[model samples]
Target: MRKLGTVLAALLVIMTAGWAGNAEAAKGIVIDGSTTVGPIAKSFAAYFMKKYKVPVTVSESGSGNGAKSLINGSCDIADMSRSMKPQEIAAAKARRINPVANVVALDCLAMIVHPSNPVRALTEAQIGDIFSGRINNWRQVGGPNFPIVVIQRESNSGTQETFKELVMKGRAVVSGAETQASNGAVKNRVSQTRGAIGFVGLGYLDASVKKIAVNGVIPSAATVKNKTYRLSRDLYMYTNGKPAGVVGTFIDLPKTPDGRRIIQELGFVPKY
Candidate 1:
């Protein structure tokens, strides 16, 4: 009886090991980077997990960090609000990671201020001056007589890079400007601070704050798609190579009807 029991115990152990190995083989994909893309990524992750029974993890550590993760092979997908720069591409090449961009949606970088602000619109030059610290007072731009508070995204943010390129026009943002890490943080700071001015993706806009038109063009889905909004940019998902398997399906989500609905529901311009 002892010999029979020992053999049965060994067989059970082998069967359990096989099950464990199968479970390990079912590991899920990981996505990280860009708080601006966090909402969309999370929504897609949730839907994919439910529909496919495949686990997916998403994180928002800003765009620069996302690129770093992809180059380092730590993430399966890197969501970026702005395109990768030349230096970034070079770095990836050195690491043997071929970063392929998958354009997912369109985003308009909306300039936001407290609701009480009366300024209707600002020219590109005026917007540039305000961020660069040249126009330090709200009264300088025909608003109330108060000092302007500039809120900017942190240095590692993709939104900050885009804002500097498009709105600053090669000018530097003021050193004294307040830097927030995420779009939600910037929106909250501007909504609560009457004299504050900040920029966020169009999807982040809400009733808590008011958006200002740039060069007479208000940021909307139509304006962004038409390229009439100066602050518009394409959102991207970067894979190490041409995406395959689960990664390919996730990146291709925006082209489907359900994915298009998800993009539009989140206030972004859907491609399909």
Candidate 2:
């Protein structure tokens, strides 16, 4: 009888420990999505974790994957550079997941090139032609004699979709163009390769690459906010529903002064 009692107590203790471990594991937030929004998500996660002592995991596997994670009950937040498409919403509904979009910031898709390239601005048609196979040489756009290396983000990327809609205007990117997985990769490739041209979120811009004007208008916070920049788009975060608890607070951070500062410092335009 004593042996049976002892074994029962031991089982109770083990069960309690297992429950505790599961609770701890579920305490943090999981964020995954666009490389364009990855920097902002990382910054917000750092700030939230430091302030609240909560664990946060952030991944930039592309917006399409992020939506999949949310629908599959894997991630708490989906950081997307573009709004979720209709098919994504339909898929989520089928799985009983209600994906809700939260606007985080504004971004301008900046056309970038190596600093050595002297060409300053491009019209919409010229930009479209360059990305398509029509214009192959840099000299055609009044630049160097080298061949224009067109760099683009992979098909899974929200940035790629936005570029296709806004810049490509229904035209396909040339098959011969190089495809990178992330915004940083595209920036790096353009910065290192002479006569290369690429587009990246405004947050990824730096001295290594020169941002050329599109239609005589340079991309900047002011230009993007005022709707003057042709490539501007709103950044987004999607939750399963109206977020509650830590997820709600984290998504609301952009409305705060500190969050607004962080957004601007990262080269994205704040909501306010």
Candidate 3:
């Protein structure tokens, strides 16, 4: 009788421990990052919650802030439009976090202007000059004589970093350039202002604004996937170490058929 009682107590203890562990693992997932990657993350979150019954929250505070959130342990996934910078990796290592990137999609920074603007293409050098204030009039670029309104993303934006590296080639943006918070915001401003020019992820393109060719190459899913678009970059989701449990499933969603459809629907190119 004594032995039987001891065995049952041990089994109960094991069961209780397992339940506690499950409860901890069920605490849900948090995602933070770029407005460029926001639509994909939100759509994936919705699908995950419906299919797996796992609660997930997503926030688009820009890529720099996404790295900060992951390093600070505030988010499980960091959606970034660019690779983690060296400093961000060092910061994560300092916090005992191993940052791992999963490429989820491909995107290009599409130069956009008002639909009424007839200037349809720009060489990379010309764009650099325009944004840097060297070429500030529409007439100089084969359009009506209107003062060009140059728009840029905030300094903390990954999109801004990419634009500076890819298009600006170390040139500083004009001191008078306007700054917007997100891809959607830039698209909105460009759509409303005839003389305005801005850049946004390919996903943000719509009839509200017109996309211009960069160096004679127009941005399209095929163009981005085939590497014909020079401005193409990979979109990423960063996690601490290898993701396991629900986090693993969520991060790998891009490899699934439904995820590809969702990416296409949102105007982004699926990487897997």
TM-score of each prediction: 0.90, 0.91, 0.90
Please provide, for model 1 over 65-159, each residue's C-alpha lDDT reduced to its tens digit, 9 standing for 90 to 100. 99999999989999999899899999999999999999989998999999999997988899899999999999999999999999999998999
N/CA/C clash count, model 3: 0
Backbone clash pairs in model 2 (N, Cα, C under 3 Å; residues 3+ apart or in different chains), count: 0
The lDDT-based order of candidates, best leading, equals 3, 2, 1
Candidate 2 wrong stretches, greater than 4 Å: 1-23
Q: Write one digit per residue (lDDT tens) for candidate 3, span 1-272.
A: 99999999999999999999767644989999999999999999999999998888899999999999999999999999999999999999999999999999999999999999999998888999999999999999898999999999998798999999999888899999999998988998999998999999999999999899988999999999999889999999999999898899998999999999999999999998
Candidate 3 segments whose C-alpha is farther than 4 A from its true place: 1-26
Q: Which stretches of candidate 1 lie over 4 Å from their true place?
A: 1-26
Top candidate on lDDT is: 3
lDDT score for candidate 3 against the true structure: 0.94
Question: What is the Cα root-mean-square deviation between model 1 and the actual structure?
Answer: 5.1
Q: Which ten residues in a row have the lowest lDDT in candidate 3?
A: 21-30
- Assess candidate 1 and give its TM-score to the true structure: 0.90
Tens digits of per-residue lDDT, candidate 2, 1-272, equal 99999999999999999999778858999999999899999999999999988888999999999988999989999999889999999999999999999999999899999999999999878999999979999899888789999999998999999999997888889999999999989999999999799999999999999999999999999999899889999999999999899999999999999999999999999986
Q: How much is the lDDT of residue 202 in candidate 3?
A: 92
